[model samples]
Target: MRVTLPLLALGALLLSTGCSGAEEDAAPPPATPAQDGPAEHVFAPGEQITADLTMYDGDDGRRTPFFSGYRPTIEFRHGGLSGECGVRLPVELREFPPGETHTVVLECGTEVVVPADDRGFALVEDGVERGTGEVVLTGEG
Candidate 1:
């Protein structure tokens, strides 16, 4: 009789523990959707644009712009009467001395001339724009 009581207690303890563990191991709830909308814009063919960049280093006693270490990408966007157009330009600059300022021309062309005021340009890195700059768009032959 005494042994029976001890066995009953042990069985009850095991059952309670098993049930609690099952509850803890249940699957988590579904993930919620993103709050912010789409971060990137998709461009149509022929509507895409490109830009030419002339990088100039000022005499502010700063280090010369290094291009060999990193590849710089530029995205130009314009809002006009027709619609909005954007282009990405990849740039590479050779290493220069800290005291010297160098200029490199990037060849970029589009069907239309983006107005100076309506034009917006950005330096892209890792899918994100690191800095902002002005670029002149030229016509292609």
Candidate 2:
């Protein structure tokens, strides 16, 4: 009887600690911004643009530099109006002066020309204009 009681207690303890492992995991509850994850930042257009330029190939999820030793600025433009987007790891590596300009050819056979700054720029894919964009450099900046 004593052993049975101990085993029962152990089982209860395990269950309380979520050790049953029988149910599929559910989506986590929403957490505070500083609690478990970063606070989401919605991209706003004409939002005093100041950031790095990057290239993202949504087709194959390849975010690589156009050339092995090249680091072109990350800017964009597609078939429609301009907008903003968030960047992740594997960004442009080459550094440039804040007000300089450079051109780079993406591995996807795209030719891009734009400012080396994080502001407005043009993205030409292998000489062909893109169909979409995260945030395009618009106007005559």
Candidate 3:
């Protein structure tokens, strides 16, 4: 009876430790900005722009540069113009374990026209233009 009690206690302790929390519930550590690496900036004529830029882990171990293991892709719209017009600039990577700041050039088709007065944000894929925005550009240095 005593042996059974001890075993039960041990099992209970193990269970408590093992099942205390879930893997998904744990918060991920804050990620450092890849500011030191290369950056691509562009200006587009549509409300949305897509960028194809390469991100380096800068450390060993299997890691994804972007949040979702994909290239940097962002979409934004101006006031009340959510679905009117949009553009997509998909950035592609041509190399891995980059030796230095790699350049990804993008091509902005002539179909999407950019207004002189409207602000624009272009997606630069590897230092090239890939995607563009249609709104007034702001908040850039």
Best candidate, TM-score: 1
The alpha-carbon deviation from the true structure for residue 95 of candidate 3, after best TM-score superposition, in angstroms, is: 1.8
Q: Compared with the true structure, what per-residue lDDT tens digits does model 3 show for residues 7-48?
A: 888888878888533356868899976543223234454324
Q: Lowest summed-lDDT stretch of 10 residues in model 1?
A: 80-89
Deviating ranges (above 4 Å) for candidate 1: 1-65, 68-71, 79-104, 109-113, 136-141
lDDT of 1 by residue, 1-141 (tens): 999999888888979877432456658899987644323333343453444333333433224454432345556566431222332323544453434433333333334444545455654544544444454444311
TM-scores, all candidates, are: 0.29, 0.23, 0.19
lDDT of 2 by residue, 8-85 (tens): 998999899978747757778888564432222223332333333434444532343433333223344322222222
RMSD of each: 16.2, 15.4, 20.0
Kindly report which residue stretches of model 3 are placed more than 4 angstroms away from their true locations once superposed: 1-54, 58-71, 74-94, 98-100, 107-141
Worst 10 residues of 2 by lDDT: 80-89
Model 3 TM-score is 0.19
Candidate 2 off by > 4 Å: 21-46, 51-141
